[model samples]
Target: MSLRGKRLFSVNCTLGLACLTLCCSVSPLFGQESSTSSSGRWLAPDALVTIAPAMEPGETFQGPVDLPLVLNNPDIAWDPHYAPKSDTLAEMGRDVVFRGEVYCLEFSFKPVRMIAVDIPSFTGVQRKNVWYLLYRVRYLGGDLRPQVEPDAFGNQVFATPQSVAAETISTPKRFFPVFRLQVKGIDREYPDEILPAAKRAIAARERVGQPLYDTVEIMKQSLPVTTAAGGHSLWGVATWVDVDPRTDFFAVLVQGLTNAQQLKMQGEQIEYLQKTLVLHFSRPGDTMDEMQDRIRYGIPALEDPQRQQYILDQFGVEKRLDHLWTYR
Candidate 1:
């Protein structure tokens, strides 16, 4: 064989090895990008797909439409006829109730992310750190509604004795979510704030091309019913600023995803509770150095088991819970 032929063969072998090494390194990154990309990414709704029932039938106090009173003169005597009913009567006359069955939208979200942006404040425009959550809501038909049936007397009565029955309600539903970011232990709450700059930055960073609505704009969006072809899901972003950097444990409380509510009796007062979605998160490492990527979605039991109980206590759950729907 010629001397130049052997040299040429050696050069070709070296080039092939280099090409293979380059592909090996780039392949992992390419795969990661594909997985994280919007088209390929999806978090299942899981438990959030079910319906949330109302605590009790909503009640309206039956009283005189007009009250007998004299603003300027204090000589007006209280009339028994115009007096309001007693608490016992109010409970007994709860015949008029609303929202027998509350339909909750199916919700799924990505890990909460953080970004810094210049926001306008009372003093002046300042650079602020913002945390935002990207989420999608889908409407799946078949929610329980109050059902009625004919009794032995041939009279239409509620199938269940309690007036609550298994039923399905078909109608258009809207989402008006209220996001509250609460720091565990300290119990400091930070309500969601709309930061246009932070939202734009997040959209570009996350490569989200869909129209991401804020809390207000999301109210107008009507979630379409899911079908075999595809399930129509609406994407939105909830943002919060001025989060305490020293915070290690926090949870995002999402309300308005469902109209399910319960009437609570506390002494002489009545309290109304709404079904809310709580997303638990933990941030580990030194508090001085705050990094968005360090914030994790679920409990970090493996990393720090000591802090797990403290975080779970805040949500009133004994065990590890990443997300849950409860009356708040």
Candidate 2:
């Protein structure tokens, strides 16, 4: 077998061993499903939501950021261009001089789950409901680089307009995830928090022996590409506490899965936005006696055609869209 094949086989074996250890050794908590529940330890294949790496040509950025000379000379770091030479003209406009490559990671995740936890507060410790989203990502080792192709005749220096080409690379990738839960209509946003007590309770309740990382801890880990036989996956959970019980429809905005971003020129100022993943969900029935299991994935379909609009309005989406990617 070739070197690539041998490496893939080794990775597959390691993954299998890890799974076996979790399944055979981990003990389930009382009332915990420990298998296929939404809050279960192992991620179900049917519940996986996969988002492929994507970026547009316009999203490539090349301006004042990330310069070699700016690092050496701190005084000129604020300049649009590096320290200007006495003989050369200083760049006046904010236009991008040279575009750079855009690298994105392939992200996959399981459905969001809800759990109740005893957390601290200003008054004292109290039991509060928490919502968490589990996810994993992999690095495919390719980046989209801006380039111009030559013509068939080879006479023209540049035949086509500047475009992007895929180039293979091998390097470690990190995920600095920022998850926000937004409730439609009310326009309330809850950012994910790092709760040590909640994390321990969740690990036990989920019966997952493998260390599940929070936002900060997961950022330090590296991800590698996965093959058919095995997957080098990094598992993480985003937790939100004290969400309003009346929130029937909401979306989770996940960022940092990819390095793709957009730069919009607005007069002399520029607005920067990063690629984000939006996961849509809605719960049926009234908010009274709210339960964690009642939360369902995707937009809820109502039996009554007349009431469908009301449900759709709650989601703030025109149609039934489970998830989508956009720059925000």
Candidate 3:
């Protein structure tokens, strides 16, 4: 067998043994009951794929979703010297389809790394590092079931029990494979533009040595009571985009708050956001004026005394300003 095949076989053996051990330990009936009948069936190796934000010092994140695949390589070779005379080598490999929601837990300028390994033996065979993009991903498993066709009357239908078990048993393991993808080469648009602009604005303001305005307090007080509902929708859309796997979306959003504060300290963030709004939304050529107008009027509309307090209570001006004003 080739070196890669050998390594894969070894990993599969280790994983099978581990699974058997686990099954034996958990089931008391299997512990004392010995089966003299050897079925000659080999358990398949489990494949996993994982996505997440790049790791950072003092930060730890976990993903609940994991993509698992059962290997079904058919060209496996069995060495008589490595097994009993009657034993035959089992080959396994399979194509796995997976999808999930991803959130950014952290953001850094560092490179992202990914690794794929065979389980049980934990042998790493595939590795990649994305220099421009780093992500941590949690795999949310997908459901693959055959759908029943409707009759002429459009009646409901059911699948056979055997089909149900066949589908469910096909995806049993929860192993996660890690991968790092670089974002820089994927597009010509630089993702870092907004951040640096905000930084430069802050620096320029500080150089003038002028008194900074209390934009944080202004944002805090200007916060409308009904604005949170709209902001939540924005958050949901951002999460659905699967922008990056490694960072928590909530954390990134919070970072905007921090950036705002930093800009406030230097009297630049709000100004930059305002400038961005005017340049992008107020221009006669800009097509987004209608949306901007809605936002402008939406804030005051929620202030009506007849509205529910909960709607007003959840309003967040900082988030709105961040959305409407921030370049990013």
Question: lDDT per residue, candidate 2, 1-328, as tens digits?
Answer: 9999999999999999999878867754421222244444454556567777766655455454433333344555243356564322222322335566676777666666777788987999998777887776766545665655666776544222343322334456788999999988788999999988788777776644356889999999876554333345666788988788778788999899777776655544466788898888876656566653466778877788768888777776688788888888
Q: Which lDDT values do the candidates have, in the order given?
A: 0.66, 0.69, 0.24
Summarize candidate 3's per-residue lDDT along 199-258 as a digit string, tens digits: 233323222122211212112222111121221000000111122332211111212211
Over 4 Å off in model 2, which ranges? Answer: 1-43, 61-94, 121-123, 151-168, 228-230, 303-306
Q: Candidate 2: which pairs clash?
A: none
Better structure of 1 and 3 per lDDT: 1
- lDDT value for model 1: 0.66
TM-score sort, best first: 2, 1, 3
What's model 3's lDDT at 24?
56
Cα lDDT for residue 3, model 1? 98
lDDT of 2: 0.69
